[model samples]
Target chain A: MMLQFNVLAASILSQYTDFEEIDWNKMWEATKETLFMTVGSVIIVFILGLAIGLILYETSNQHSLAANITYRVVSILVNVFRSIPFIILIVLLIPVTKQLLDTMVGPKAALPALIVSSAPFYARLVETGFREIDKGVVEAVESMGANKWQVIFKVLIPESLPSIAAGITTTTISLVGFTAMAAVIGAGGLGNMAYLDGFQRNKPAVTLAATVIILIIVFLIQGIGDRIVRRVDKR
Target chain B: MIELANIKKIYETKRGKLTAVDGVDLSINDGDIFGIIGYSGAGKSTLVRMFNGLEKPTSGDVTINGSKISALKGKALRSKRQKIGMIFQHFNLLWSRTVLENVLLPLEIAGVPKKEQKSKAQELIRLVGLEGREEAYPSQLSGGQKQRVGIARALANEPTLLLCDEATSALDPQTTDEVLDLLVDINQKLKLTIIIITHEMHVIRKICNRVAVMESGKVVEEGHVIDIFKKPQQEITKRFIRQDTNPDSEDTDVALSQLLTEYPEGKLIHLTFHGEQTNQPVLSRIIRQYPVELNVIQGSIQQAKEDSIGSLYVQITGDNDVIEQAIQQIKNMDVEVEVINDVTV
Candidate 1:
């Protein structure tokens, strides 16, 4: 029976040549591209998402007409960007990305699209996190004579850190996937390697190895994210 | 002194204009433990919030320490708030911070020197009796300990005015007593003007020297705590005092039945004592002066700041004429007597 199984595997392997011979040099370069794109977008998204979330949270649930209008405007802006499908969003941001970066091909070109799509998505999580805080805590800080800046830094931001950290973890994972998707448009990464050097070249080993690496990256992101969330979540 | 003149707060809701605090006037002296007693939505929170300018009045002025709180705006209002501190029923402490750090918040906000902030926070942690727990987070503490942290944080700025918005309401009865005791200790030691807002009359009777009874967004009765305890003016005020007098109405009924069965021929008389009169040996005097067996059926003596206000229900078993004479004598001593039941009146 073992000889029969080996014969069956050989017959299946014979149809695909170079299936075990994954080019390590190209794989390393693809990994660097994916990591570069993800890390860059994650950094930019963190700041932009936090600012957007703060504006959205502060302006909402107020009595002033100006505040209501500001909330409405910002809310619509976030929703518009967040609701667009990521695949279409990359293509939609082509002209803007080109005008901003002067070219739109390699991993660097995917940064703008990745940030624009995920930052607003992450902002919603940040807003929900802010909402989870007891309004009374805000009042208590206000009673302490804390100015707006102090309230944000001391109470609002620090209190919502667990949520923020969790949001970033999810965003970073999505960014990894986005990096792969951006490769469809010739932005080189593991996804581009899988498509151009695996599927087109008929080498399934490259595709399988790329999938394993992406999954590893996601698991690492989640593990580190959970530790961070637990460390900050005292409540 | 804190003076509020015709302070009114009206909130605009989608349905219509809602009156939160309507035309209320109050004056509180320094070193006074003032209580604003009211049911939920009686405008007590709104009125108290005006003290720190957390909520501005629509058509009145709040004057504290010679500055008009209602008239102050932006930076002026914020700076004015520094000298005034507030605590909440939930002990709204930042769970992200340790006890020491929580207390350091107000000091840092006020721009107190970094060197002094640490020591001052440590001093307040010790003040609230949490000396060894300074490094602990609020989540690791009990409800009472959290309130202690809240108190410490509120007092971090050395605020002259402290507002306790149902500060002890969330605590158990024992914890409530401890927190109240801490407030009393702070009041005496620091001479902080404390304004307490509570629906529980027990709190007012325990610590407040002066009180205002709120009903439907207005102060229905305002006076010394002893006076209100002795002679409740309005029906709402009487209801609040009654809650303290007989916390469980069912218990009172059961007690009356037991007392009636134990002494069928006995006289059941209720006596009321005001302020300094509570300390007098009136009941002993009654027993000593008359040839009667006076079994004290039920009794409660409540301390109201400087004095005690008490109520007692006594059953007298003796000659009818002697019992009547004893009741008359108690009335003559300025102790009001009412026959609980007409069995032996």
Candidate 2:
């Protein structure tokens, strides 16, 4: 029954799209590349963003460590990155990207630029998340003789989990858009497939199919993120 | 023991240097529940925060248990903080954590073993009367229950000194009484010294044995609670006492001035009765013995610890000699009398 359905769908698809002309193998490969880039960059960005965000939060006050100097430096750096457009940033980071990954035109090479552009964006979100936490809660933990590390891990992070989760969801969805833009440099993804085969060759059906798949991935990501946030948020 | 000697705090802001706490000296003995009453921005909060080293004084020595707290830093300061627990006005429990988890935070910071953390947290939860709600989140609990969780968490480290920063200010009157009772109970049972900062005179009157009244970054008056209530030395202290005692719109001084003008035929006297004298019928006795007629104006009786303090304003009408005799008679019964108006014959 499944084979019959596939053959029937193939015939219908051929009416609108040339099945013989479509490279099914390459399409599957692009789908894998998009997933690989999104997953890898999200992990790196999450860690980098959290560290940068926490430093921004901690040093932003007179009571915290290195309040004056480090806070200013980090704040300026984060703002510089956040202000630059992602497309322009990708081109500007080509040299550093080459030095870091030894290549500048594949899914693996796109990572360094993707991380630099997205981590700062996510860091701002993370900072806002931490700010949502009550200052009294931080003081209460500090009053317990908790060191800086303990206060961050045991109180601030846990208290800001729901906000952080929401930030992660937003960051991940933006990464999907960034991943599509990365395809401009020959990085294999659904974006490349839609551009080369659909737009370049005037195959509108392929473009529609790729867009539908991307939407499905985004919906799944949002659903999972919302569930985790609701589970952790007691308030 | 906690001692603050010449503590001062000055903040440099865009508006210029502002002194939050001026030079002040205070000492709290072992097992004392001392209260500091002040309005907002009066610097009581800054004074109490100095105890736990949360706020560093610009120039002073804060000694707790014979070690200067102001000199400690890093690990030493943190270790000292473990022995000084604090509860905030907002309760400040982590919303993501359950009641049991919130209570276990201090123990976790102190690096207690995992197994003992649960048992000890459970013990504290039970102590604060939150036994069945261990798994409940802070948002699920009422304001009173959240404060119970705060109290439990504060007591988790078995500290000798517990600082309450307007701990019951956000709670309702009945809940405030309940929390105050719990504090008194904890003070008696554990023999812990507590420092409570508040703007409410009734809080000081209810549970505090000693109190200091602060005004404009200075300690205006300090003494036993009953004594302060009976004989307030500062104008601010008198205003606070009157505000607590009378529910009327007019201030006590305004009311007294009005009464003096309206009732011109008698002498207006302010009478204070303390301890056993609060319950005695001293007014009726004086009226029966003397030829003076007594007209009661305003009066209230407040209970402070085991003692009761009462204040009464009365108009006495009679011949000059008889009025003097009646005043002397009331004074003989252990009441303090002050004549507000002296009408010559």
Give each model a TM-score. 0.91, 0.93
TM-score of predicted structure 2: 0.93
Task: Give the residue spans of candidate 1 off by over 4 A.
Answer: A1-20, B253-269, B274-297, B314-329, B338-345
Residue-level error in angstroms, candidate 2, position B286: 2.3
Tens digits of per-residue lDDT, candidate 1, B42-160, equal 99999999999999999999999898999998899898899998999999999999988999999989999999999999999999999999888999999999999999999988889
What pairs collide in candidate 1?
A: none
| Alpha carbon deviation, residue A103, candidate 1 (Å) | 0.6
TM-score of 1: 0.91
**Which digits, one per residue and each the tens of the lDDT, describe model 2 over residues B1-345?**
888999999998889999999998999989999999999999999999999999999999999989999999999999889888899899999998899999999999999899999999999998889999999999999999999999999999899999999999999999999999999999999899999999999899999999999988999899989889888888789778877776552655676777678877678998988998988999999988988889888898877785888889888998889999899989889898888863221
lDDT of 1 at A192: 93
Worst ten in a row by lDDT for model 1 chain B: B336-345
Per lDDT, the best of the predicted structures is 1
For residue A219, what is the lDDT in candidate 2? 95
Pairs that clash in candidate 2: none
